[model samples]
Target: MSGFWGVARAIIGREFLRFVHQRERFLAALVRPMVWLVIFAAGFRAALGLSIIPPYQNYITYETYIVPGLCAMVLLFNGMQSSLSLVYDREMGSMRLLLTSSFPRWWLLFCRLLGSTAISILQVYTFLALAALFGIVLPLPGYVAVLPGLFLGGLMLGALGLVLSSFVKQLENFAGVMNFVIFPMFFLSSALYPLWKMAESSPLLRDICAFNPFTHVVELIRFLLYLQINWGALIWVLGSTVVLCTIAVWGYDPARGLMKRKS
Candidate 1:
């Protein structure tokens, strides 16, 4: 048990060190959300007048409504970035060396996921803090309440990234992932516009948003930020995390690691 923790700690420490060295990555993460919150939200505030959503009692600013979604975006992007790093490691043969360790692959991978998630969580809080400064604050308790949702959302998205890493042939392939998976997931969900708004244009699109896993992640964060329980989002996120992790573990199985087969 202690050995597992020891290995986990080492892996997490390495990830942290790597993150710190890449100061630009941290800054970029913060900047993307801030751009959306400060510039984009401000520009859209008048155009995107929100109706009374469940967690909201009355009309709310577009900035306030999109905060959870932007928070989810941070996790989503970081998760994919984690996977991109994994592919890079594999290509450089580092992952091969790491896999040779006595630790189980799933344990090692989970350590990687946890480490990336921790960094992502930090970026999220920083974004939230900056948002508060811009007068886009959630309630005090909401700050505390949002952590669990962020953690779970990060875990699930990280797992998804891991799965993608196993399939992605190389670093160059990552751009396509951002275009296809990340963009589609973000835009199709309740992240930007409410489901009813989508339904107004197209019921099919609204239904698609309802089923999106990212939607549940955003919804979970939204509800928790308001001190409410979104049981459906909770269930969806938990189930999605489990399934994605299982697949990721399978994708990187030493007996059939994609790197080995692809190389």
Candidate 2:
């Protein structure tokens, strides 16, 4: 038990130290969503009208409506960036050393995921604070209430990134792959517009968005931020996390998976 905790602490600490040194990474994470909130939302405030939605008691501004989604965006991008670092570590041979440790590979990976999720949550709260400064405050209790949702959402997305890291062999190729996964997931979800809006445009497209895991992620956070629970979203996010984590574990399996080929 001591050994297990020790390993977990070391891995999580390393991730934190790495993030602290990478000041630009922190800034970049905040800037992308801030751009959407400050500039894009402002432009679209008049263009896209929102009705009083479930999590919202009254009509809200475009900036307020998108805050949760942008928070999810921070997690999504950070997850992919964490994966990118994994690929880089693999090339540098550090990941090989870590995997070869006495600890179970899954345990090591979970620690990595946990660490990434922590960094992501920190970035998220910072974004939320900045949003508050911009006059997009949520209920005070909602800030405390949203932690569990953020943790779950972060783990799910981080697991997805772990699965991707196992397959990506080189650092240079990750950018294109990130784009392939990131853009569609972001644009097609309820991040920018509600499902009803999408349904109004095209029911087929709306169905596609409904099926998207990212959509549920956004919904889970959105509801939690308003001190509500979207039970369906919670189930979807939890189930997706398990599935993705299983796939990631298999992908990194030495004897039976991609790691075997790499070895």
Candidate 3:
């Protein structure tokens, strides 16, 4: 038991140290979402009118509504960034070293996911703090309440990164992931706009958005932040996390991994 905790702590510490050294990465994570909130959302607020959506009893400002989505955006980007680092580690052979350690592979992978999720939670809170400063405040309890949703959402996204890194053989090839996976996941989801709005435009697109895992991630946060429960969103997030994590672990398995080909 102690050994498991010790290894997890060491991995988490390493992740934190890497984050501290890369100040720009932290800044970039916050900047992308803040830009959307402060600039783009302001212009769009007047153009797109949101009705009283679930978890929102009254019409809300675009900034206020998008907070959870932006929070998920922070998680999404940071998750990819963490995966980028994994690709770097693989190219440099550090991943093999870490994997070959005495610790069980699943435990080690869990630690990695946990570490990334922890950093993501910190970034989300910092973003929320800035949002509050900018006059987009939620209920005081909402701040505390959002933690689990953030952690779950972060874990799900980070697991996704792990799955992608498992398939991608090189660092340079990640651009395709950004183009195909990241962009679609963000834009097609309920992150920036609600599904009813999409329905007004195209019912098919609205149905597609409903199936997006990122959509549930955002909705989970939105409901938790507003002190509401969305059972559908919760089930979607939980199911997706389980499925993604299973795939990630399988991808990294030596027998199932590219290592079998190389060996």
Candidate 4:
């Protein structure tokens, strides 16, 4: 038991240290969403007016409506950044060393996921504080209430990243792949606009967005930030996390997975 905890601590500590050293990564993570919130949302505020939506009893500004989605954006990008590091580590042979250690592979991967999720939570809180300073504040208790949703959403995105990393064989190829995954996942979801808006435009596109796990992730955070719960979103996010984690474990399996091909 002591050994297990020890390994967990070590891996998590390593992730923290790596994040600290990469100051630009943190800046980039904050910048992308802040741009959307401050500049893009402002321009679009008049262009895309929002009616009162669920978890929102009154009509709100575009900035307020998108806060939760931007928070989820932070998690989504950070999750991918963590996966980028995993691919980098694998290329450098460090990932192989970690996997070959006496610790179980799944445990190691879980620790990595936990570490990334913790960092994502920190970044989300920081973003929320900044948003508050900019005059977009949620319910006070909602700040506290949203932690579990953030943690679960982070894990789901991080697990998806893990699954991607296991399949990507080289560091050079990851950036293009990330763009392919990230942009579609972000733009197609409820992050920028509501699903009903999408439905108004095209029911097929709306259905696609509803099927997206990232949509549920955004909805989960959005509801929690209002001190409410979206049961459907919660269930979808939970199930997606389980399925993604299972696929990640399989992807890293020695005999039957991509790791074998890499080895």
| TM, every model | 0.98, 0.99, 0.98, 0.98
lDDT to native, each model: 0.92, 0.94, 0.92, 0.94
**What's the count of clashing pairs in each model shown?**
0, 0, 0, 0
Candidate 4 residue pairs that clash: none
Q: How far is 2's C-alpha from truth in model 2 (Å)?
A: 1.0
> Candidate 1 lDDT, tens digit per residue, 1-263?
99999999999999999999999999999999999988988888888767897999977889999999999999999998888899899889898877888988889999999999999999999999999999987989999999999999999999999999998887887898767999999999998899998999999999999999999999999999999989999999999999999999999886786766767
Candidate 3 lDDT over residue span 144-252, tens digit each: 9989999999999999999988888878898887678889999999999999999999999999999999999999999999898788998999999999999999999
Mark the 10 consecutive residues where model 1 has the least summed lDDT.
254-263
Per residue, candidate 2 scores C-alpha lDDT tens digits across 28-142 of 9999999999999999999999999898999998999899999999999999999999988988889988998999999999999999999999999999999999998999999
* lDDT tens digits by residue: candidate 4, 1-263: 99999999999999999999999988888888889999999899999979988999998999998998899999999999999999999888898888998988999999999999999999999899988889998999999999999999999999999999999988999999999999999989999999999999999999999999999999999999889999999999999999999999999998888778787
Native-structure RMSD, model 1: 1.0
Question: Which window of 10 residues has the lowest lDDT sum in candidate 3?
Answer: 254-263
After superposition, the stretches of candidate 4 with alpha carbons farther than 4 Å from their true spots are: none
